[model samples]
Every structure is written in structure tokens, then in C-alpha cells.
Target chain A: MRQSSSTTDEKEIRETVAIILQNFSPLKENLIPILQSVQSAVGYIPQPAMKQVASFLAVPAGEVFGVATFYNQFRLIPPGKHPVKVCLGTACHVKGGNIILEEWKRRLGIDEGGVTQDREFSLDRVACVGCCALAPVVLVEEEVFGTMSPSAVEGILLRIRIEKERRSGCGGNEE
Target chain B: MKTITLTIDEKTVEATEGEMLLWVALDNDIYIPNLCALKARPLPDANCRLCWVDIEGRSAPVTACNEPVYNGMVVKTGTERVVRLQQTALELILSTHPVDCGRCGKNKRCELQKIARHLRTKLKQKRLRDISKRLPIDSSHSLFSYDPNKCVLCGRCIWVCKEEQKVGTLHFAYRGFAMVVTAFGGAPLGEADCTMCGRCVEVCPVGSLIFKNAEK
Candidate 1:
């Protein structure tokens, strides 16, 4: 049953890739846009999609992978439901950004650029988010929490846990 | 191509109008410290910022690899500002690189070491704290070994693999501090579709990529 389901997923991915590839000519210049469309459709650039792209463009798979990794915008893994990004820009670094990052890593039990075992959260460190005014900032999904401290990191994660529990109708007090 | 003359370091030199300043300077026996440039490849990667030169009119130093030569252009290859920028770039590259030059295969022949010495930059890595990921070495390929810790990410190997040789065996993976050059799909180099071409190793400026049988 698992093997059959995985085959179905592969078929789905191939269909998605075919639909996206039809719009653009298979030129070398179209690689970036093709990758962008695939990422947008699938939420991340899976290894299978990269292989499909390499064959479609008649380039080596290594070349495609290299180009993708050179840019900071590409993501290899599927992001968690609530993606966490900590700023490590020059301004943020000066404002104890590393301390806040350490707190997040400790609480999440994941290092930089890792997803939690439960897949509920993923942590990443960005060079900058263009909001330098809010130094030592952490972005959970689209909401930016500024002037973050180590204790505040705990508060944010706890809040997220409670919110998830509430939505699922399972409060902390429940056995 | 029409030949044009430009003033570099107060010395007049003749070069083709469309020739890159870096190559023209090198052809005339004028040294410009660079890492990602190759005489065979006309296109410049411009990833390494070590070849900055002060153009008379430009506000900031321009990479010699990307700057095209023009008639009557006055260029300063080494100035206080240029040297400082080169030093800063070298320091940043050194920060993530392992400082075990004594044991490295490239040791005395490393371009990074030569540039550091040329600029009088200290090799202590004190400016920026070291944040090395300490990635595992890949000695899977019978022809060569790839050590990420020694890599400077100059893009020379990638260019050689993709453009010159068209083998495309090596590619960049991840980004920012986690960035690394790896085989496709993160496969072992020996298991990939590698033809065992030594071009990547030949073009590498550091000991990150080296032939397995090379004399140690």
C-alpha cells in the first residue's frame, strides 16, 4: 500500500511538472522561472522535480542543483506549517541576535536550517528581512516579532503550542 | 578588436577595447589578485571580490574581472581603499575556511594565502568569528577528494564542470552558511555520472578539490 501511494505521488509530481513546462520553452534561460514555478506549485523544490527539470532543459542535474543552491531563495525541504526565521543581519547581530537564535534552537530542539521531528516547525536564519529597524527579530510565518529576547522566544513557542491546542479542542489542562 | 590604451598604476598599457581589465593587466605582466578568473573562460564569475581596482571616475572600486577596458581610463590596481576591500573579502573567505594550511595539499601554492600575504592581512581570522560548518570530506571519487572545509566557494570548479567540460558533476548546494558544492541529488561523487575529469581539480584555487594520486 505504501509503495503504491508513493507511485501515485510521483505521478502527481510528473503531471504538475508537465503542466508547468508546457508554458515555457525548454531553454537554458528558462531554468530559473521553471524552478520558481515548481517551487510555487509544490511549496519546495523536491529532488524529483530537479531531475525532471534537468532532463527537460537538457542540462546536467548537477548544473541545475548548483544554480538553485547559489541563490538564497531556494528551499530543498518542505517547510513546516509554521516556519520560523531568525534575522542574523549586521544590525540584528549587534542586538544579541545569536542569543535569541540559541533560545529558538534549544526550545525547538533543532539546529539552524532544520525541521522539528513533529514537522510542526522549521527554523532558518536569514541574512536580512529588510526590517533592520526591528533588530533581533523573529518571523513566525508572516508575523514579525521584534526586539526579541531569550525569554520572549519561549513565550512565542508556548503561545503557538497553546493556540494549536485550542484550535484542536485540546487544552493544556486536559489529561 | 581595436586596441586601446589605459593607465594602470600610472603605467600606460595597450589592450583590446572590449578586453577585461583583469586579463589585459595579466597579459601585460601586471598582477591582479583574483580567484574565479580563467584565461580560457572569457566570461567572469565576479563571485570573488578580491580583484577590486580603483577607476578614476567610479565612486567605488570595481572588480577587475568585470570591468571592460576603455581608452584613456586611469586605473589604480592597488590603493589604500582597494587594499582594504581586498583584505576584508579575504578575511571573510578565511573565516569559514579551515586554517590548517600546514597540512593542506595546496599549502604554499594556495592563492588565498598568496593574496593574504600580498595585502598584509593577518591570518588569525579575528575580524569575523569562525562559523565553519565542518562538513564531512568526500573522498568517494577515485580520481579526487573534495573537502568542503577547505573550499573558498570561488565558483571556479562549478564553472569548469558546467561550462568548460559540460560534465556538470559538481554543483552548489544549500545557501548562506550552509552552502556547499556537492554532486547532484547529494549523491556521492564516485557514484554520480562523473567521468573522472580532473578539470575541476585543476581549476580549483585552493586544496578543497585535489587529485587523489597527487604527491602529498
Candidate 2:
């Protein structure tokens, strides 16, 4: 049953990928655009989709993967429902951005580019969010939390939980 | 492919006009220290910054790898200014590279060692403070082992894997000091779609990648 379901998932990916790649000619210059399109369409660049792009472009799978991993803009892992981006810019790094990142990692029990077991949160780092005045900044979904500290991570999570509870009418959200 | 005559270290040599000066020099038994000049990569990465040579009519020394051979071109490989520049570059590379040559797999065969010997500099260069990345050794691949700590970021392995072999299994990821040669999605060599071709192992200039049989 698992194998059959996986094959279907693969088939779906193949179709979606084919559609996304149809507009893109097999030029090396179009590689980035194709990847971006597929990412926006599929939420993340799945390994299979990456292979399809590689084959379409006639580049090695590893080179494609290399380019994918080289840039922070691209994400290989699927983002969780609540995606969190920690800014580690020069100002933030000085103001303990790493500490806040560590706190998040400890609380979530997952490293960067990882999702929680419940898929509620995902963690990733950005070079600079251009919010140097608000050093040590974090973005949780659409909301930006600046001057972030290690101690404030729980409060952020609590606020998220409260927001969830309010959205789900208290009893709708399960333990 | 016009054959051109150029003077490197007072020695007249003939090479293809568009051929890189570093290769020309090496071909004619004129040794210019280089770490990143793969014959396969036409455009030099110039990341090593070690192959400095003084070309006449140019005030500042230029890297030999990036300089193309031209007719009547004169190059001084070992000027006082060139030596200083090369030494500083080697010092910076050594700063990040773990220099325990005694226990290293590529001890005698290492390019860093050869360059240092040719340049007449100490391997344990004391000018720069050490900032080695002590990443874990990936011994997962049955054929070879990879120690990121020992890598010099030469891009030789990456070029061989991606360009030459068309495997693209290994490549540079991240930026600044955090940059690393990682597999697709940062997977291990064993788990990645690597064909166990061992080209990456073969092209690595340092002890970063070594055949399992060659490991101590």
C-alpha cells in the first residue's frame, strides 16, 4: 500500500513538474527560473522535481542540487504551516541572533531546514532581513518579531498557540 | 589555436595564444604555484590567489591562472612582491587548513605541501591565526572518506564531479567562511546518487577526500 501510494505521489509530481517546465526552454540560463516556478508551484523543490529539471536542462543532477543549495532563497525542505526565518545579519549577529536561533532549535528539537513532528513550525536562517535597526529579528509567518531574544521564543510560541486557539474556536484544536 | 612565444622567468616558451599563462609555464618546466587551475576549467576560479606573476607593463602582479599567453608577453614568476603575495595567500589557506601532515592521507602527495616547498615557506605558517573548520569525517562511502576540516575549498573536486564526470554530486554550498562542498540536499556520499566513481576523491588536492584503502 505504501509503495503504491508513493508511486502515485511520484506520478503527480512528474505531471506537475512537466506542466511547470513546459514554458521553460532547455537553456542553462532558464535553470533558475524553472526552479523558482517549480518551488512556487510545489511549495518546495522535491528531489524528484529537481531530477526532472536536471534532465530537462541536460545538466548533471548534482550541479542542479549545488545551485539549489548555494543560494539561501531556495529551499529543499517543505515549509511548515508556520514558517520562521531568523535573521543573522551583521547587526543581528552582534545582538545575539545566534542565541535566539539556538533557543528555537532547542524548543523545537529540530535543526535549521527542519519541520516539527506536528508540522506546525519550520526553522531557517537568512543572511540579512534589512532590519538592522531591529537587530536579532525573526519572522513567524506574516508577523515580524524584532529585538528577539532567547527568552522571548516561548512567548512567541505561546502567542502562536493563543492565535491558533482563537482561530479554531478553543475546542477545534486538538492536543 | 595560434602558437605564441612568451617569456616566463627569462625562459622563452611556445604555447597556444589563448592558453592560460599558468599552464604554459608548467608545460615548459616553469613552475608557478597553483591550487585551483584544472585543465578542464578554462575560466580560472582564481579562488586560491597563490599563482601571482609579474607581467611587464603591468604595475601590480596578476594571477598566472587568469592571465592568458600572448606573443612577446613577459612574466616574472618570482619577484619580491610576487613572493610576498604568494606567501600571504598560502598563510591564509594554511590558517583554515588543519596542518597535521604527519597523520594526513595526502601527506607527501598534497598540493599544499608541494606549493609550500616550491615557495620555500613553512607549512605551519605562524603569521595568521588558525581558524580550521573541524567538521566530522564522512566515512559513509565505502570507497572513500571525506574530512571537511582538511579541505582547502580549491573547487577541483567540484569541477571534476560536476563538469568533467557530469555527476554534479558534490558542489559548493553556503557563503563566506560557512561555505562547504556538500552533496545534493546536504546528503552523505553514500546516500546521494553518487555512482561511486571516485573522481571527487581523485581530484581533491588535500586530505579532504581519500580512498578508504589509502586512509591511515
DockQ for each model? 0.49, 0.49
| lDDT, residue A109, model 1 | 95
Off by over 4 Å in 1: A28-33, A36-43, A67-75, A78-175
What TM-score should be assigned to candidate 2?
A: 0.81
TM-score per model over all chains: 0.75, 0.81
Clashes of each: 0, 1
Model 2 per-residue lDDT tens digits across residues B1-216: 798898988888899998888989988888889998888797879999999999999999999998888999999999999999999999999999999999999989999999999989999989888999888888888899889888899999888887788777787876677778888766787787787888888888899999999988
CA error at residue B33 for candidate 2, angstroms: 0.5
Report the C-alpha lDDT of model 2 over A1-175, residue by residue, as the tens digit: 9899879978988899999888989999999999899888877888888889989999777678877877778888788888899989899999999999999999999999899998899999888888899989999886789989888999999998987877896565342
Which CAPRI quality tier does the interface of model 1 achieve? medium
Error of 2 at B208 (Å): 2.5
